[model samples]
Target: MVRRLSIWAVGLVIAACAQAPAVPPQASAQETPIAEYGFGVLADLAGTRWRGEPGEADKEHGQPADYSEWDWDLGGSVLVNRHVLEDGSYGGVTYVQLSRKPGVLDYVYITSANFRTSGTMTLNADGSWTAEEDVKGLPHILKVRSTGRRHADGTMSGVSEFLGDDGEWTPGHSFTYSQTTAPLPDLVPSGSPPE
Candidate 1:
């Protein structure tokens, strides 16, 4: 009698469970967002904007300061960077994508000055990144190498060197950038687009 009663109770519970309404599982509120591009090496750069004034060397040469905006686009598949100089002298857009090889990124830069560069960038072990690029439209500059690192104080610093015709790597530009809320100004604003 005891066994029969236990089985009957189990059957009732099973029937009740079977008759209950089904509920889809809900996502956890505490769940973290997955970093896109798998490696997430450049995650910190997304949704950030920066401003860098020309260095003393550049100031002495009348180079204008520049502003940069970085963001993830194309459903987080590509990292886009747009920059413009203060005096409207130059501006460019850069697209960064994951290369065929893991842990490497390929970038293409096109500027208003009709210069273009294609490069591969790698993240260093010390939390810095380095880029090696081939420059087009500049006869004197054959290649460009650059490195950037973010500081703890929320600023960034980078140095670029140009490979000249003489095969010497000369200093190109050095920048110390601070985070900014400003947008990149138009390089050549002519008005609204034709409808």
Candidate 2:
């Protein structure tokens, strides 16, 4: 499966390049997102800190990753997620997003300490993002599918669902992750300019 995904990703890059327009002498920060091996739009998540607050969970049926801290690195394209239940031990995922058609639809590819998975996330008409994960692994007891919607207060709420072998889904614990940093303007160099 990984092999097939790799080949498909390569093909996507080639197709996007063939369809991409010429870059002007200078491109602004608002320039069209570029998909170089699927790392373009994912760049937006950089330099952000997410603090995930736990909600309610079923101790018997639901298995939620209790995240107390999540820090996304701008330089490394990595997210270090600290688990609340298991202190000192944590998991990290390197986020990668590839545009299948440059500006049409992009897919998310995440690589973590143990596994790599791919999926899609679409922005809803209501200004929220609904993300779907390709694989959610915990094995037999329950096969979970990840789905989440972004909230307006820079908070993302997500829950796991158990996809029945017969194609049904049961929702699990829902949690919210909020951005820790308030949006601040860039620092003025020194004797720059008077606003």
Candidate 3:
């Protein structure tokens, strides 16, 4: 009986694998360029909040506790990132703005994290972005850098690293952002009042 059950389990596993598709559903639709690149790309990104899921490295760091949500608000010409970790114990907010500069081919991003660390980056042709900046008040001069990319899954993902005065980049933690659900609109009776 045990041998027979094992054979059945093997068959089930094979069937499941065969049923899986090559690409995830909606990949082609979402990843395709919806509009010309540049500041225009921010249109679909604006008025929306993307939430991040902590990776294994982040979890191992004893962070990203519940009640700590990573949300990036891309509205107006600026991007506001709010994070609450350990129920508001230790978390910092960041503000990032993207624009054009003289002789710059890509949109330059200026970021201020908790008013401490300041950085700049640009969107790359590969649909990825990177930033580099310094933290004002630390034990030592600290330079931080991060790289992230957006995917058709409607998520922006990245990792961050700390550059100590020694100029060594400590392995950083992973971060990502996914769209937050929009609220339903309120209804009002119109045309003719219901009886």
- Total backbone clashes of model 2? 0
Which of candidates 2 and 3 reaches a greater lDDT? 3
lDDT of 2 by residue, 24-126 (tens): 4465424433332343333344444454544554333332323333335555544332222212122333233334544334444432223333544433223
Per-model C-alpha lDDT, please? 0.56, 0.36, 0.38
Please give, for residues 1-195, the per-residue lDDT of candidate 3 as tens digits: 110111111111111111112333454523432223233333344344333456676556444421112223444554443333322333344454544441111222121111255554544434554456666544433665666666565555666666667877676556554455533122222222111
Residue-level lDDT of model 1, residues 1-195, one tens digit each, is 110111111111111111111222452212321122343546556776777765687667665667777778899888777777666556667777877664467778776655577877755444565678787775677787777666667666666777878999877666667768888766772222101
What order do candidates take by lDDT, descending? Answer: 1, 3, 2
Clashing pairs in 1: none
Candidate 1 vs candidate 3: the lDDT winner is 1
**By TM-score, who's the top model here?**
1
Clashes of 1: 0
Per-prediction TM-score to the true structure, in the order listed? 0.74, 0.48, 0.56
RMSD of each: 23.1, 14.9, 17.9
The global Cα lDDT (0 to 1) of model 1 is 0.56
Which has the greatest lDDT? Answer: 1
* CA deviation > 4 Å runs, candidate 3: 1-38, 65-77, 98-115, 182-195
Q: Which prediction has more favorable TM-score, 2 or 3?
A: 3
| Candidate 2: C-alpha lDDT | 0.36
